[model samples]
Target: MTDPITIQWTPKTGLPRRLTFEPLEKGYRRIEREWNGSEWRHCGSEHTTDLTLHPPEDPPTLEELISQIHGTWDHPNPAVLTFTNEDTVAEINGQLRYRSPTQDGWYAVTKTDLESHLRTAGYPTIHRLSETPYNRADFTADSIPRQ
Candidate 1:
């Protein structure tokens, strides 16, 4: 068994991040991202059955990094779009229709796109919008008008 790999990333904003890659059962690999908070909050995880760790003899290059960041465009799945409002959706369908995550205030992405984005952004997984329907009645107690 090989030792786990650890990588540290310090973003300009928010908190520092740590990434760990560990070998898993059945020749699978697990990659986890955690925020270096007071409590070590978990950000996400990724599982791959065919992950290989390369030695320092061939380190990743800047082009590879850039490719990893922008390669989502070649994904087979269509991207999803999350809009803040109907207007934003309409605007996205109008001008920036080709682009996911509308320019105004929306996030659009397909699963592959999301995955690529997460991987490139150093996030293990991407959070999807809640599919469960929300109702006003469910929030009756918490619903208070702002004065």
Candidate 2:
């Protein structure tokens, strides 16, 4: 097996950031990040040992991982700017209306927006649920009842 992938970033200021990607059971991989700070503080995912891993195969590239860390993950939220697939720039009646779905009716978000809502929620890192390992039919009939 290959050694865990480690990425290091040194900003102009502040401590350096290091990310380590480790393989997990069931063909999954987990990522852990630490800030080169006093006592080597961890930046996110408090439960170090319990941190879930990402799948080993098809792991996100370094650029993708950096984007995610920089608050540009694919998930959408109103606080951050996000563009959806249906967004278009058009002059409607001469007034520019950047419109799309709003989180709380306060603002609009496009389908193609690329901002992270994690900061707004006060989280150092954002996590999203991966696709289920099995489909509903894969389970026994008695395992789950119809809603």
Candidate 3:
């Protein structure tokens, strides 16, 4: 069974949109939404499972980077925050994950909720990622402040 995929696109000059795909029997159903000044409105849906509709060409959203921080364990817990730009998607322990370093499962939340939580936690985040190509999961913890 394929997991539900959420691809976020924050363009350089416009509002961002996040498309989530729920896998079905043969294909998938997608909910396309765009921010319309106040909130996200349903742009449309599709019968096909073509992921190309929300390609990973865009940069990682702040939410995606925050999820990585959620999985980032400092010492005792396993270091789960690994980076990969495979297919242009900056994924960490797979995208759209809600589990923290010590959690069992997940607790899904809305984008607004996520933003609030991350802000409250105050985990130092890297504002920019290097465009330089690398072979492995080459992310560093430089954004984290020293104790």
Candidate 4:
């Protein structure tokens, strides 16, 4: 049996779904799953012999990305960033921090800095989910888990 090909997507509900194509005897079995916080739950499945998968569509919009930004994975004190209706305002660790320039490797970042820089900045060498993976969070910095 050949290895399965898995595809992932995040919908309007903010929950992530995964579609896996597993090679079968004369066809492929497609398994659909949704992420329920800590695990992936099966939603549905099907079998197809003739199926052509297409490339994924456009990336998530800035608004979508911003909305997904929440609790920090490696934060010591379980920091969370809550965005208000005002674009320039955000509460970090329950303290309101206004729009401002955040230096590299800093823990606190303003909403403006996140939208303008963090989104496009180079990813740290670390896996962003695992410790001792590769890069150090202290030098590069950790990120919220989305993918």
* The best candidate in terms of lDDT: 4
Alpha-carbon runs more than 4 Å astray in model 4: 54-147
Instruction: Give the top-scoring candidate (TM-score).
Output: 4
Write down the TM-score of every candidate. 0.33, 0.30, 0.31, 0.35
Local accuracy of candidate 3 as per-residue lDDT tens digits, 54-134: 576875676666565454333232223222221111234433333333333334344565456544453323322233232
Whole-model Cα lDDT per candidate? 0.39, 0.34, 0.49, 0.50
Locate the minimum summed-lDDT window of 10 residues in model 2: 87-96
How many pairs of residues collide in each model? 6, 11, 0, 0
Alpha-carbon RMSD of each model: 13.3, 15.1, 15.6, 16.2
For candidate 1, lDDT tens digit of each residue in 26-114? 55455556565565577777665545565446544433433333423223321222222211111112221112222322333334543
Q: What is candidate 2's lDDT per residue for 1-147, written digit by digit as tens? A: 446667788779767777775655434254445575565466553213433346557644433533443432223321111222222121122221222232111222222222343233222222321222222222212222213
Model 1 segments more than 4 A misplaced: 53-147
Q: Compute the lDDT of residue 66 as modeled in candidate 2.
A: 33
Model 4 TM-score, all chains together: 0.35
